[model samples]
Target: MKKNGGIRFLRWLILFAKRFLKDDMPASSAQLTYYLTLALFPFLVFLINLLSYTKLSTWSLTEDLLTVLPAGTMQIITSVIRETIEAKSTTLLSFSALFALFSTSRAMNALNRALNKAYRVQGTRPIWKNAMLSFLFTMGLIVLIVATLSLMVFGQLIGEHLFTLLGASVYFLHIWNLMRYFLPVAIMVLIFSLFYRFMPNTEVRFSNVWRGAVFSTIGWIVASLLFSYYVNRFGSYTRVYGSLGGIIVFLVWLYLSSFILLVGGEINAVLLYGDSKIK
Candidate 1:
């Protein structure tokens, strides 16, 4: 029997996606992503509103940082920040004081459960224990996140300064290319480290965390770019759906974030599930 080339290609693609996506791959990822996003939706809304009230979004700080970059690059970064802030909605702010810690913890439980369900592993952490762990871990995570932002900020500053001093130096150009690769690794380490330190039913392996973080972080960046492209090209939802656009976009991003969280669980499962290693 002659195999159809197109169908054969499709089958391989499906297998490839499943291997990387893990278990139910896209479907499982999507389920956890959507569920967790819906749960965390209000927190995001509150934070955005908080940022608005503080007028932090209109740029008092990045302007100082941008002075070192060429006008063109500076303009692009500033423009994206400006447009994103301006597009934010005030109605979302009304829900801020309404957030309950107890409820939020439950939402976190949902995330934990989603990951467990996807991989068929039982998570044994008590709710209070996981919540405490998540909270303390969040402080470290936030610090690392802030440090990454600083690294990124200082990185551009150094680059701009180097270009000013070195002008056409070919060596400087090569080093700049190297920064791109190393920076992503650093960012992924922070991301995966947080998940490793916090997400497991038991203590997690560092190697598992690293793989999950690196893979999922890369997936997230690619997904976000594609999502933006999609919204710009095919979605008129902001104008068409109004406030609901905020909900939809928020959901989309959260869904992806949750999926990334699950990837850490999947990695842990790959290593620790069944057999004798876990004991």
Candidate 2:
């Protein structure tokens, strides 16, 4: 029974993949990539600036980013972050915040459209309503990122203290180290699940969303690791694009990331609607 169930699931997944492609994921992804690129630097600057006033340093923020981003991409991001911190001018803060809000909302809007398409639902929200929802989502994402960074920075300290109080052994420390990596990925999955649940026009059950979230998170991690490995080993965008290679690479990465996100939403749609045509 289990084996047959697995086969049936695979068949459904294959059909979902076909439907996703038919829905024009690539075009939507490209649009998302553009908005993401517009938002990326401003959002990072705003975030780093906000963190600078706190206990966290730019290096800590960069390290958190390094966990998921490729080496070259990380370098580019870190350089910009460092520059933003060193400039120390409040003049850009207002501008950065506004730009980040607008661009991020635009990106979220694109995702909202993609999700609606996947769910076979027509968009019924007014412009103001949609913009407000996007704004809220954008803020939620920023908060999620800040919380994740805080955990990465302080989780170890808290763990060590708890472990020492309990008289735990070295094995626990090893496990904690692994959790440091796994926790961020788990948080990402939860965030993706939230996006799946709330972003679409149609309602989704939490149970069904989790299936897609897990699938999407695993797919994202595998794709990111493989892309990073390929880039580190054989990729040479710098030789081809000179100083602009990093930007090019970043854009391509955003596109792939957007594609993965849509695929996840498609999975949820398939499960929810069961091969129904778009409404």
Candidate that scores best on lDDT: 2
Error of 2 at 203 (Å): 2.0
Q: Model 2, 130-158: lDDT tens per residue? A: 98889888877787777777668877886
Top-TM-score structure, candidate number: 2
Clashing pairs in 2: none
Error of 1 at 181 (Å): 8.1
Error of 1 at 178 (Å): 5.7
Give one digit per residue, the lDDT tens place, for model 1 in 216-246. Answer: 6677666666665666567675787665664
What TM-score do all the candidates reach, one by one?
Answer: 0.56, 0.88
At residue 205, give the lDDT of candidate 1. 62
Q: Residue 31 deviation, candidate 1, in Å?
A: 8.3
Error of 2 at 177 (Å): 3.8
RMSD of each: 8.6, 2.6
